[model samples]
Target: MSLRKRLIACLDMTDGRVVKGTRFADLVDAGDPVGLCLRYAADGADEIVILDIGATVDARPALLALISRAAAVLDIPLAVGGGVRSYDDAAAFLDAGADKVSINSAALADPALVSRIAQRLGSQSVVVAVDAAAHEGSWRVRSVAGTLETGRDAVAWASEAVERGAGEILLTSIDRDGTRSGYDLQLTRAVADAVRVPVIASGGAGSAADVIAVLREGGASAALLASLLHFGMVRLPELKARLAESGVEVRRPLPAPRPEEVAAWRG
Candidate 1:
């Protein structure tokens, strides 16, 4: 059987509110993280990614309480990232019901952290996030919530992270973020080629066709969406229908409700 294309909805949380922005700046409130997760679960999202964008900088807790609430309400898998610096923080997220913990700045600062987490939580439980920007004609990794440039080649870092036992890479194109055009296919394909594990392409997803383009051209195993879903620009059922029609392997959609049957039931 062909591998199914995975669709993930990212909830960028700060101070318990879901926020989104372009290039990691000018964030606007989306909604409550818990409520959004529940809604996405109902919408047939494959998985939910909760990113605590403020935790690391503020030295605050990683929002385990919020994650716990979301987990309790969602049946789909949850992956928590941001401000996850130590083993304890990662463990806390898992304890609070996260299926996976994603590390980026922490891992880049100390690459061995990924190995340590992988050893304890298993490889599949660890995902390394790489926020990359095309700079000086090369893809360079960014850290500290995309505010600080790392001056490191993204593909090289991704390869090293995987070798250190990261089971997945959440590759986000900083340039393409909030653009609603499409993914940076070249950058995504380069990182995907460098890593052995699954690469989730993030940023610049505007529509279902954009999702298809990323999977096909970027060689990504999955795509992460934010603005499109949060703004109601794309409906999950219709997106899945388009993917199916285009011959991409995706989760089968739930059957549509019959209008007459629904009317009789409501009556």
Candidate 2:
């Protein structure tokens, strides 16, 4: 049997506040990152990924103190990114509270960094985030919060990153991000098939069916939920229930409330 598909909650933070926007622009505040992280964990998210979306653009380190605080409260796995540029940075994230550290432009600039981080922290601790957008008829990788295209094929880069010791691929669709249309299934399938490691598909998750399509038809190992979660469009447990009904294996679902409990709660 294959590993169960994971449902991950994504929190994109900027200047200490969680934000969401279409195509990574026109941002609006969502909520407190750490508070939201705790909520998702309690609501049965398989994992929680908190990214400092502005850290790289601002040329500053991740808010380690905030990450540590989030990590301290969570029982599930935590993956963090943004402004992580070196092995030292990666190690620092792990030391602070992240179970895994995500690297974007840094890994693209120096693929060797993946190997070094893996060599020390193990491949399981390394997550290579590939932000891709539609170009012509194929997908190309983007950097710096989807502001610049690298001209590298997203599928090819995912493969290379895995070869360099990236244990997992955090593939996000820049075009579909916050659009709520659906995931870019083609790009997701291409990278998922090209990379041997588990691929977590991000961006464009509007409904449970969208998640089902990405995880099933798209061959993604995990489905990343952002706006759907942050904006209260879909609660994590309810979404997981829908996925379970759709026959996509998830970590677990919230136990059903007893009849008596339900009755008492209804009072």
Off by over 4 Å in 1: 20-30, 56-62, 255-267
lDDT of 1: 0.86
lDDT of 1 by residue, 1-267 (tens): 677888898988788777853332223423667777767777778899998877754435438778888888887899998888898888988999999999999999999999999999999999999999998777999998888999999999999999999999999999999898899999999988878899999999988888999888899999998888877788777887888888888877667579986888852
Pairs with backbone N, CA or C atoms under 3 Å apart (clashes), candidate 1: none
Instruction: Quote the positional error of residue 250 for candidate 2 in Å.
Output: 1.0
Among residues 3 or more apart in sequence or in different chains, the pairs in candidate 2 whose N, CA or C atoms overlap within 3 Å are none
lDDT values, one for every candidate:
0.86, 0.86
* Superposed Cα deviation of residue 233, candidate 2 (Å): 1.0
lDDT, candidate 2, 104-154, per-residue tens: 998888889999999999999999999999999999999878888788988
Instruction: Count steric clashes of candidate 2.
Output: 0
- Residue 174 displacement in candidate 2 (angstroms): 1.5
